[model samples]
Target: MIVATVQGNEKGGKHITVKDGVKIFGKEQQEYINNIYDKFHINRIEIIGDFGIKKIKSKEWFCYMKHPEVDASGRTGIAFIVWDKNTEDDTIEKTIREIGFRDEDYIKFNKEYNKIKKGKSNKKKQLIFLVGLGMGLAAGLIVITLSMIKK
Candidate 1:
């Protein structure tokens, strides 16, 4: 579980640190965060606020980003606050509203997460099926051997 904040402009942001509330490792942190940003299409959208939920490195994260209000002549900068999805569900729900979310976004995120879950489930299903088949075969061989001995 982790939480953090970062500031960015058109170029990009900086290293996320404990000061922001999370201690993510080197390049891996940047990669996963970028993935989350991509999944939500953050860069393409032009608005004051937005938020989303997605998995990063097998863990779910809640990200809320917004551009601070500025005068017409001033440049707008982006700020992001992120946290582990497992904790404070009610709190995060209330917080993201300051940004925005739609039922479709939830559906999309869940669809992606379930795909990952389903992939892992397929492996388990195969293992269970193999085990069951092996047991059935073993029982059949035992029954044949016993009947032969009776003869």
Candidate 2:
């Protein structure tokens, strides 16, 4: 579940190819990957390389690249990549579609994850209720036996 977003604040350097983007980013690229690791609890993440390098080392992985930053003419834009190996594709797609990358992505992912977790929570609640009911029944049975013995 490696999700990363990078922005080049340099003026007139907005739109660029991934290869050119990596060059423009330079050390910042690694910093971005590191930041993603720090930000998310993903299974694994590794940078294949820059400049037309598409070598992936993971067996199950997904990548989403999008450009939300664009000029009026839509000619210039900044692109970011979100990579993940362990997370579900639907989860990733929903997150990207609903909130996009960067801070927005984080918030949306948390929200969606919580929603998906609701099913498990219901099951937990049912288990807790059953345990409590069994305990109460046993306590009642013990009280009845003790009272009957006294009688």
TM-score of 1: 0.38
Writing each residue's lDDT as its tens digit, candidate 2 over 74-150 gives 54232334444465656555444433345654454456545545765798899999999999999999999999999
Q: In model 1, which range of ten residues has the least summed lDDT?
A: 93-102
- Residue 58, candidate 1: Cα error in Å is 9.6
Whole-model alpha-carbon lDDT for candidate 1: 0.50
Clashing pairs in 2: none
Each model's C-alpha lDDT?
Answer: 0.50, 0.46
- Tens digit of per-residue lDDT, candidate 1, span 67-145: 4433344654333444554656444433333233345644443465457557777988999999999999999999999
Angstrom error at residue 2, model 2 = 9.8
Error of 1 at 11 (Å): 6.5
Clashes, model 2 = 0
